[model samples]
Target chain A: QQQVKQSPQSLIVQKGGISIINCAYENTAFDYFPWYQQFPGKGPALLIAIRPDVSEKKEGRFTISFNKSAKQFSLHIMDSQPGDSATYFCAASSEAAGNKLTFGGGTRVLVKP
Target chain B: DTEVTQTPKHLVMGMTNKKSLKCEQHMGHRAMYWYKQKAKKPPELMFVYSYEKLSINESVPSRFSPECPNSSLLNLHLHALQPEDSALYLCASSQDHWTYSGNTIYFGEGSWLTVV
Candidate 1:
């Protein structure tokens, strides 16, 4: 079963514009949600994360808006740049899973300059 | 360092050949994981190790074996594989086994395995 689902298989954004990706989950046991960015030939790196307790969390230009009751979350990148072009993935995990993340299919983002 | 290092960034093996992928981390993480990813697909969880003990196995095939020799080391053993098994093998580590606070999962560069 796919616990986490993401939309927009690919996204194109102009430089300095906002880029957004959305995701949803089915398991209520999941309490931790994280977003990862991956470049070609590299590993997925943690970008930002949010807990169910908070509705939103911002780190630099990246923000994660989470809804516990709706079981949904999204990542927003402000002032998008060409360097930000990469694949993004959203993942979730429960406390009992020992941080074993269930990931979304991934969204390829292209920030055009 | 906060990096997870993987050996042999690329590997090409035959279906009958046996090979091993190694992962090492220096962040003193107590939990480690192995995931398989196809092109344009999200990573699929294969195994999880906590405190050098096997904690979760996702009903993976026997052809894929995971070993945690220590807190910082993880290994994936492959044997008698098919061409369809070729994919990127990723290793990740987390600070603790119980992740109620969204512990970050640091990943390695990934090992690209091509089975012929």
Candidate 2:
């Protein structure tokens, strides 16, 4: 069973536009949510993350909005640039699960200048 | 180096051959992990080690074996593998195995393995 589901397998956006990706999780026990960005031929790097206690967390151009009751979360990149194009993955894990993350299918984003 | 390093960026072997993938980290993290990822798909957890001991195995097949000789090194031994096992193998490490609030995991570039 896919515990975490992500939508929009791929996306294209114009420079300076807002890029959005959505994800949902079925496991209510998951208390930690993190987003990772991966470039070609490289490992994934942690982006912004948010917990269920917070509704939103933003770091520079990246923003993660989470809904605890809905069990849904979304990532929004404002003023997207060409260099921001990469694969994004949403992951979740609980403290009791030894921090073993369950990841989403991932979304590839392309930004055009 | 504050990074997870994996050796042998790529490898190709026959079904009967035995090969091993190596990973190292020097960040003093106590938790290590192995994950396999297919093209355009999310990574699947294979193994986890904490404090130089095997913690989670994910019920992986017997053909794929993972070993953590020490706290800083992790090895995955492949023997009698099938074509379906060809994929990108990633290694990751974090500060602790039970904390999720402030733990941030770092991953290696990954080793691409292909079985002929």
Please report how far candidate 1 places residue A91 from its true position, in Å: 1.0
Cα error of candidate 1 at position B110, Å? 0.5
Quality class of the docking in candidate 1, CAPRI style:
medium
- Per-residue lDDT tens digits of candidate 2, residues A1-113? 99999989999999999999999999998989999999887888999888899999999999999998899999999999999999999999887785889899999999999
RMSD of 2: 1.2
Going through the candidates in order, their DockQ values are 0.72, 0.72
Residue-wise C-alpha lDDT for candidate 2, range B40-98, written one tens digit per residue = 88888899998889889999999999999989999999999999999999999999887
Model 1 TM-score is 0.96
Off by over 4 Å in 1: B99-101
Q: Give the local distance difference test score of model 1.
A: 0.92
